[model samples]
Target: MAYSYEPHHFEDFSVGQTFESVGRTVTESDFVLHSAFSGDWTELHTNRHYADEEYFGERVAHGPMTFVLATGFVYRCGFLERTVLAFLGMNYMDIPAPVRTNDTVSLDMEVVGKKELSSREDSGLVTIDTEMTNQENETVFSGDMKFLIKRRD
Candidate 1:
């Protein structure tokens, strides 16, 4: 039987709360698939030999692709379900280090703040800071995302 989890309501979220998602690894196929789907043919992403000669010493995973995968991990771990209404936008998105193929990555989220929209009684905005780290424990990317969430009341 497929287990059904009751989604968290906005009221359940509080400042200082932290959530973590399962880890995932970047694979060559993932890189290829993402590159193909997005039409991003930058040498650093699609040309391994060229990348090895110019920079990264080898083909590197696309930055946006890495972010997408990390976001999927978060969703799989149940961070965005009934509690989340709409994804607003991202802030301070930074890809400080290149994610390489086979690099294991995970997501960490911290609830930085929350506010009840005066105009909406049933929903509010929650701002959280998210960080993606590699197996070697280096932060490859970081950002803040705001989501509209339903209030429990």
Candidate 2:
């Protein structure tokens, strides 16, 4: 089914609403660039030779990179566009599986909870359960993300 690219406000969200994002292929360039940008040129993510000897048996993308890409995929869905006031925070983030080069990943987001902000009538908080899965349907990352979203009223 075709997904809409329209923004969704706080009042538009309901518990159990889910969104599936477009897939993105992770690449060597992604690792290299992420390492360079984050100043985290760790051998596990950069040195294939070292990584080849490690538990994963090959270079793995940095954990933060996975989260970043996952969020990007969600943004591409266009639901949070201008309606999102701020990213409050995340909770219980987990990287259960390694994300390697050429792995296509997609994000599955479900609205788990919502709370009206007594301090701000113009906005509210929405909590979503996020799981990022690879092409093989293995969960690479999971977390709960909270966002302050604008209210339509």
Candidate 3:
């Protein structure tokens, strides 16, 4: 089945709401482009030979790269398309495993909290717990994201 791509308002979300995204493989080009764009050509992310001597045993994708990709994956799910007013921030971000080339990744998101804003009647805050997992179902990145969502009322 195809994704819904429907935008959801604040009132449409609940504490137990969840979403899953389609898989996207991490590629060598992703590494190269992200390294160039982020100006983070660290040896661990750019040099295979150097990374081989390190604990991870091979070059790994940058933490920020994985985070960005996770956000993109969630975006593709389309629940926040036009109803999201702003991205407040993230909390307690953690990377539990390395993301290597050819590792297919997907995102799982669940709404953990929702609060109406006293200062703004048009929007409310929604907190989502996000996990980005690789093909092996190992969580490579995880965090809580807060967004200001437009209320239908």
Best by TM-score: 2
Better of 1 and 2 by lDDT: 2
**Where in model 2 is the C-alpha error above 4 Å?**
none
The TM-scores, one per candidate, come to 0.90, 0.96, 0.95
* Tens digit per residue, CA lDDT, model 3, 4-41: 55888999999998888889998999999999999999
Model 1 regions more than 4 Å off: 1-6
**lDDT score of residue 94 within candidate 2:** 94
lDDT of 2 at 106: 89
In model 3, the runs with Cα more than 4 Å from the true position are 1-3
Worst 10 residues of 3 by lDDT: 1-10
Better of 2 and 3 by TM-score: 2
lDDT ranking of the models? 3, 2, 1
lDDT-wise, the better of 1 and 3 is: 3
Q: Write candidate 2's Cα lDDT for 49-111 as tens digits.
A: 999999999999999998898778777899999999888889789999999999999898999
Cand. 3 TM to true fold:
0.95
Give lDDT for model 2: 0.91
